[model samples]
Target: MQLTVFFDPKFLAIMSNRLQNKKSHKILFLDNTLDVGGQEKLLYDFLSRIDRGRFDAVICCLKRGGYLKDAFKKLGFGFYEELLSHKYDALAYRKVSRILAKEKVDLIHSFIHPNTVFFSHMAMLTRSVKAWVLAIHASGSPAGGRLIGRFQKLFLSRVSRYVALADAHKRYLVDVEGLPEKKIDVINNGVDVDKFHPGPSDPDFKKGLGISEGEQVVTTVASLNRRKRIDLLLQSASIVLEKRRHVRFLIVGGGPERNRLEHLTRYFGIEKNVTFTGIRDDTPAILRASDLFVLASMRGTETFPLVLLEAMASGLPVVSTDVGSVRELVVDGESAIVVPPENAEALAQAIEILLTNEEKARVFGMKGREVAVERFTLDQMSIRMERLYEHVLSRSRRAD
Candidate 1:
């Protein structure tokens, strides 16, 4: 009899050295802009909770840094705005190369496809960057209607690793985007449980939003984009209002689709029953004030929405269309009600079920809160990201 164990010496050496080394690596996160959206906010929340002692983070926006730049700076992280006059700007490329050389960035992590392409070009200009990671926050590629969308397949080679928000999202990357399965890491998006928890709804907050007493509130927090299907929600609201007039639908967040969605709301003749709150900083408060949360998004537009986690964390029963990786977060019937996407009748029926049955909705909310706290918390996500950084840096070192 013989017992033999085979292990790569390089892996053992890397593991042994990682235990003794605590050197911090500087990471440059590149994005098209720091707009007030879920992806931007996710990056902010992760950065705020990331292990400051283990890693350093810098944000470089190819265009403007948008509103979140100042918020990022308040966290003591470096932020830069490198404007690109066009898609292919030689001067901007040179400027970004200087930034890479001066900052001595150890790794480059980019969000969206355009920024990934920008990172690929900069990698060729500077030898200081050792590794780069691409995070596909959305479900499909060629998002945001950019010219670079046509050429992303040619530029993905420079990415050291790819991050998918959920298992289904990972499959899409591997099957549709042709990314290698081994190189893709599934890191589920997490929410701050402490910040968004079950709490008493403020009367003034409800009153300010025109929510009357004894009225059941059904809220949906999503960017008012066409893919979000705000129109579908409004159409569903019309049906729900026909039955439950006491139910008020609160449409939170804003985007380019506001005007068109508002027109659709008017078209559905549910303007009085629905209130578009636009983009607000007080999402936690809004979620707390709601009796039920609804998300009516079309397929391929969402990839594990952060708003769903916020709703669950706030202890609100969710009635969402089955899209993206939503099923990964909530059980179809236990934690929340899942319905078919793009179906107003089914969406309306799901909302009515939760709204009409008070006890069921309460139980659903409790279970959802449990799920959010136990599985998806800021601490859990931050620790996983820290380990990922270590793994990428170690591999980059071994390759050298």
Candidate 2:
């Protein structure tokens, strides 16, 4: 009788290791939180579309939970939570070190403030991770003023690589933080062009919001915060209504400034012309239903506003304040009208220029759409990230 022999368990383990060595690189993303902000959304978009055949993705947060936690879970990623209790908690260092060792993570990419400092330090101390990439999405001055800026500058040199969301932000790091310009990589924020393409306004959405068919819709999708300067949007809306009574203003977000903004709407006596659709999930649809998109931010908090790209993808012309990297995104008289920040009269005039000139508005919208599809698609961003990962991994292997 012939006896068949199965492979030994030790042999099988060795074979498995060999196969895994030929497999995709494992990447871990560490963020301060999973909240529904620009940075969090960008992380989601990048992770969701990254080529799984080339990179295995995992996510962890310094804080335990956030609004986007469920959304991230739904994307079928491995997730860890709450590595720290307080800012200086030593237990976090141990936890991070243990996680890196256990997962056999090849690379770690961290975003935003303290998370960047913490993860970069851990990667250096443990030497467990092969490469560390830090992503900074906003200008440091408005992120938390000069104090937080100092901390970032001090810790940034410890990481293996750096990413900035805009050229303006890259300049900020070099000019204000004293970092070498060559070390930073500028990756502009991108959107899903296929999902946010130009479409007919949803008739049901318009009706539900009490917007009539013939009225011009001017909309802004931003958190109603003082820095956002939404009050200026309302003041401008009032000015637009006096000249064009057929126009309607749609404000699409919720924040602490909601009550004050509502009061301003009443104070201007144009309550019927404005409707605040608080915290909508259907932002793409809202953009389709609008004639113009406006953002009157009063601070340097925005590096590259993702909403501007979304508005362009939806075929809506933009009118925004000259803040952060907005001018880099929008040409002065082509894709958008850029006005000085905090000037209600200038903001109103810009809005009226687009409101009255349909041909100019159409041309601007079309050009914006073209620019977004060419430079800011999700696929383009993912491809750039893949290149970055490969480059860093190649360098690490050479060093070893």
Candidate 3:
């Protein structure tokens, strides 16, 4: 009798030696943009930390490029922006296929949904392109939006590998879409622990934001989207201010919901207490300035929020609703506080508890920082990803 086991301390290293002995495999990382979103940030961190000697990597953006392209250029990584218009853009598809073949890209790793279809075809279309891996960032549940949405749901079955950011997302693909469970893998998005670690509260940072001395600042850094529930935070601000007037609500990040949510703040008459700072790049500094962090997202699909780790790293206790992987990341009254979704009153109360109790909040923040440093660091995530890539490649090699 025999048992199968897995251990590969030298997989990447062996691959690197193979590359030196022969030809190296190239990677084409396809995404919608190089923006400051979760998936984009994950890519950026990977672009920095992955074992560069093991494989050659180039980041290719589908449409409008963002700040990250410039960052990549500065780091001397290949950056290309080609607007695909839509997934089926024939001209864009041809261009991508040509690049993959001409560049000798071994695999195409897609970060968005449309790219899955585009690249999967490019693999067949190019005739020699090998592997295609798709990372499902959203919940991936079937929504009855339009004809296009229906087609997207239908297309999910044909992707090479369906990678979920959380177990919930994997379950959605398997249970909701009937995708094979064996084809799905859970890879939680990781954070840059060094840059986002628990820094000392910057007094100057608070002063720059016009926050007076000793006045606590509670903040939420997320897109001003309906899913993120920025309006709920505004309402919670109204409730929190009525009780604790010394605190300020700093709303970071921007989106289509900005003007409407700002109006909602005015409607609630808490505009004085709420500050809408648009899509801030200085998020780590802002988190350092904050006393507590709140993620009031109404969406159950948010598997792992990078902001929660950022908050923890900045030494700020978190007050987020019990949704998605929030339960996985935070412990009630221990590492962080969790409330029910859409309950602004409860949300505000949780924020108030963290605010009113300074010592407990600091302890929670410290514990959260510990968890982040130990478990969720960028290095750990990069190594995990390197292994995943190797696993997919090894399977592909075996199949061939």
Q: What lDDT score belongs to each candidate, Candidate 1 first? A: 0.83, 0.83, 0.76
Candidate 1, residues 152-198: lDDT per residue as tens digits? 66677667788899999888877776679999998888999989999
Error of 2 at 57 (Å): 1.3
By TM-score rank, best first, the candidates go: 2, 1, 3
Model 2 lDDT per residue over 266-353, tens place = 9999989899999887888888888999988886768899999989988889999998899877777999999998899999999999
Candidate 1 clashes: the total is 0
Predict model 2's lDDT versus the native.
Answer: 0.83
What residue runs in model 3 are displaced by over 4 Å at the alpha carbon? Answer: 1-23, 85-88, 140-150, 153-158
User: Across residues 50-133, which tens digit of lDDT does each residue of candidate 3 receive?
Assistant: 665576787777776786678777756567786587656747776676677677787778855555465555564445556777
lDDT of 3: 0.76
